[model samples]
Target chain A: MAQFMDVHHGMKGITADQLREAHQADLAIEKDEGVHFEKAWADPESGTVYCLSEAPSAEAVQRIHERAGHRADEVVPVPLTV
Target chain B: MAQFMDVHHGMKGITADQLREAHQADLAIEKDEGVHFEKAWADPESGTVYCLSEAPSAEAVQRIHERAGHRADEVVPVPLTV
Candidate 1:
């Protein structure tokens, strides 16, 4: 599977706890989609979230987010060094 | 060239202007390295910068950051859809 970084913006009003809840809720669906969410970071002030995952395609990553009720602002493919 | 998103953290003390200056400095070396920096976003509060670019390898992306005196916290390869 290829790696992808899905960046989410427009989360300015969200609290850290709320963001963590949303993230955990979304992560539950990963197993069904063949996507491995490696890690994630949330910017409390900007309300932006960055998730690092390994998946088959960018669309696959978006689908997971969509299913979780969040839209990915941008999904960028990550190339492996080796 | 493959797309990559280099995520940088640990800028809690950096100002928006200072971050912008650092980003501009790094972008200047991109052309010489055969890297294209498409876009970037900075969070002043957290001092995190996310850069989207197209390059041949993760190492090439890191080399640009290294040359500019900033270390990339993570370099993830982005796969193109078409």
Candidate 2:
């Protein structure tokens, strides 16, 4: 499974709690897509939401996000860690 | 509290488990700086490590990362969420 970090813009003024809720909702439906939504972070002031996940492809990540009602602006594969 | 996302480059070929350990180590000492290391993500293929934190300023975030021995390449304040 490849790791990915997808970005969402224009989410300013939202709260971390709310973002968590949305993330959970997405997770509820993600298993069907073979994706695992690992973690999420948001800056309410910047309206930025980032989600990290493992999937077969970035398209799978985007498809899940779009189905869950928050499409990402960018879905970049993360090939390294530490 | 302001949220920030910091990125570390050249971390390729590392594992998620290792990143988590480093993040935990940083958390153990982060309280002294008043910065909360919330979550982390890494891409072994891309050599990218990203950290999400809550702090008074971006400088605080950088300071904490520097202290943790993984200086960030970029620390950008996220002023909004969704």
Candidate 3:
């Protein structure tokens, strides 16, 4: 599985709690898409959300986000580390 | 300027202090590249670093990170919000 870091925007006033709820909800169903959401981070002040996942493709990550009701604005494969 | 989210990996065991130092160092010179890094997040256990910036292009973002000595693994434009 490839690793991907996806971004979501336009959530300027979201709370951390809300983000946690949404992330948890997504994780509950992401396995169906061959994606495993490993972690999530949100900047409530900026309205940005980020998710790290291991998946077969970026599309699978987007699909999981869409089903979770917070589709990502961008999803790209991470090619290097450190 | 467009918003970009960049990811860096392979830094497992890095401390938040080191990440902050690197981010600050990058900011000190990013203006020359037309990039403004607004914030950064790091997960030491996962060795993943995420940065949010406003720039003309992803290339500018990559350039800034490269100059900072912690090149990003991926840099993608973020197009949506909420």
Best by TM-score: 2
TM-score of the B chain in each candidate versus the native B chain: 0.85, 0.94, 0.95
Lowest-lDDT window of 10 residues in candidate 1 chain A?
A: A73-82
- For residues A1-82, write the lDDT of model 1, one tens digit per residue: 9877678878776665676777776789987789887766655555667777889888989988899898799886644221
Give the per-residue lDDT digits (tens) of candidate 2, residues B45-79: 76777887889899888887888888899787875
Candidate 3 stretches greater than 4 Å from native: A1-82
Better of 1 and 3 by lDDT: 3
lDDT of 1 at A68: 89
What are the RMSDs of all candidates, in order? 13.2, 4.2, 9.2
Instruction: Pull out the clashing pairs in model 3.
Output: A9-B81, A9-B82, A10-B81, A10-B82, A11-A47, A11-B82, A81-B9, A82-B9, A82-B10
Better DockQ candidate (1, 2): 2
- Residue A57 miss distance in model 3 (angstroms): 25
Fnat per candidate: 0.00, 0.43, 0.00
- In what order do the candidates fall by TM-score, top score first? 2, 3, 1
Candidate 1 off by > 4 Å: B1-82
The order of the candidates by DockQ, greatest first, is: 2, 3, 1
